[model samples]
Target: MPLFSNVPALRLTLAYAFHDPSSLLPHQTIPTLLSLPLPLGPSLPSLDGTGRKPTIRALVLDKDNTLCPPETAKLHQAYINKIEKVKECTEFSHSAHSILIVSNTAGSSPAPEHEAEAKQLELELGLPVLRQHPDRKKPFCGPDILKYFKDHGVTDNPREIVVVGDRLATDVLLAREMGSWSIWCRNGWRNPAMPGRDYRGFFSKTESRFERIMTRGFGNTAPLPKAT
Candidate 1:
């Protein structure tokens, strides 16, 4: 099984989260990513105190809970509606190139079934899925993700991308690792119509609670990227 695929990343993320909980904090928190304004623009508040909006050329979205229910491939109707609204309301368009889904279970696991799941998600969701990577999962997969976007002709600059997900440790940390911005989905998809659990387990819930408690009082701002 690929369950162990995230063990290494998890260890590192835990240490990082404890040492710098603010780094795992979200720039903005919403019920779900679907609520984020489409075609995010400079009118949005600056991530830092500099008052300069970061460019948004592409988006990296998490699948489980963030877009759909945890451990499921089905896209919620709310998100589907939101995507259609985005296409109609703005020039910004979503395709396999402009928007991508990054999921630890569907794509980044080590098992072959995970690869098949990724392909299935691509076909069902109408967006590209990052292919399975044995060692590159979230936080650690930022470089691979950047290369994927670059090769696909999306923006090459990581600063131009925004990573949206429900998990602070993986999703938020991934953005920090990639030098991109982050949007945290605090509640995930909570619609009663959607079936299945939102969080993976008690560990997921406890860690998130801990991170929230630790990050309290810190402003909602993206931390400066480390020097290359």
Candidate 2:
């Protein structure tokens, strides 16, 4: 009974598609892959358009929820180690240019504060940060963002990209649109209605269906996200 799905046209698509997280939060949502031209994975989707498993290439990470809490000025100390370990994880180890932060800083108070924040984060992580100006923020994948990726040299194949974030409407949906993979971090912005979190009372048909889709069938491997 979530507010977004009351529309009659969406019920059937909600039933068969759109799944829950079977693996640990932020590991990677498998059901998001159902729309892919090929099958879902035990291995990664081929990025070269050759139907072979591709090594992880570029990562477009969300900042606020996935790496740190929202609206904070500094990088949370608790997540510093967790972020470092991402390089050590089985999938990633790309060159410095390959890892990018694609977070929204449009709403930051005092306007340019987000730029300073991005610089500070870049210094802390030793990685390039791409904090979008509010004018071209997330859920949009504006020309600037895509142009940055192109300028920095991502694979021509979009499937090689991986998006990690807390919101489905932004992070996951953006990746889906790009034909890339997505991971939903249950750790972000703490919404009761987020994919895996449970809420009270008789759930609406939409909410129940959403939970059912996102909670099951993933294989666990991702580390528990440490909080700030």
Candidate 3:
């Protein structure tokens, strides 16, 4: 047998994931989600006028309120069409560009449940999904998602990859650490900005007009916001 054969069963265990707060933009900036440039340009070290305009070739997204309500395990009713359009933007050649869901669910849920949920997401989205392995919760689990990228031939080209999420600490920091593009999407939940602040909220088209219209879509959320 080779040094390491195929993967083996993962032992159930408590997991933890961390992010570098200094590496991320302020969490409050997410309120301006739709205000940022679409398909964010690559931040690679500039080479005088190589002028290869960067194109977004891949996306790594968060799970919870970013795509669906917490633990609903399905695409949010509102995001259905918007996600499809975003999918179109990430597509290259005949196949859709890789869109991965990387989450730190190990601390919160058992691995089996997370795996099942990820499978459902893969079915609905027609893309890949990655979650913390039962034996390895993030930051250790981060390698699992990265391994999938490596296995699938995702390159080190930062211009071609992105990570979108609701939290700046985890998602943004992950992007920074990985040297990939970052896009933060905000919802009515999880405000780490206000340490002790307590409030409840709901999302509706009337209030979340941007989400309802999905103006921050590819090419649309340029200098002038456009919608599909």
Best model per lDDT: 1
lDDT scores in order: 0.71, 0.51, 0.47
Model 2's TM-score against the true structure: 0.60
Clashing pairs in 1: none
Ranking by TM-score: 1, 2, 3
Instruction: Name the weakest run of 10 consecutive residues (lDDT summed) in model 2.
Output: 31-40
Encode model 3's per-residue lDDT on 138-185: one tens digit a residue.
323445555666677764354456667654445654555555556666
**Higher-scoring candidate on TM-score, 1 or 3:** 1
Per-candidate TM-score against the hidden true structure: 0.83, 0.60, 0.58
Candidate order by lDDT, highest to lowest?
1, 2, 3
lDDT, candidate 1, 105-202, per-residue tens? 78877577777778877776577888746667777888888888889887788877778888777888888888887888777766656535465555
Model 2, range 112-216, lDDT digits (tens) per residue? 777777777888887777755444455456345556667877655565666776555556555654556666654343332343653222322243345445555
Runs in model 3 lying further than 4 Å from the true structure? 1-22, 26-53, 90-97, 106-110, 134-142, 188-228
Q: What is the TM-score of candidate 3?
A: 0.58
Worst 10 residues of 1 by lDDT: 87-96
Between prediction 2 and prediction 3, the one with superior TM-score is 2
Residue 204, model 3: Cα distance from true site in angstroms? 19
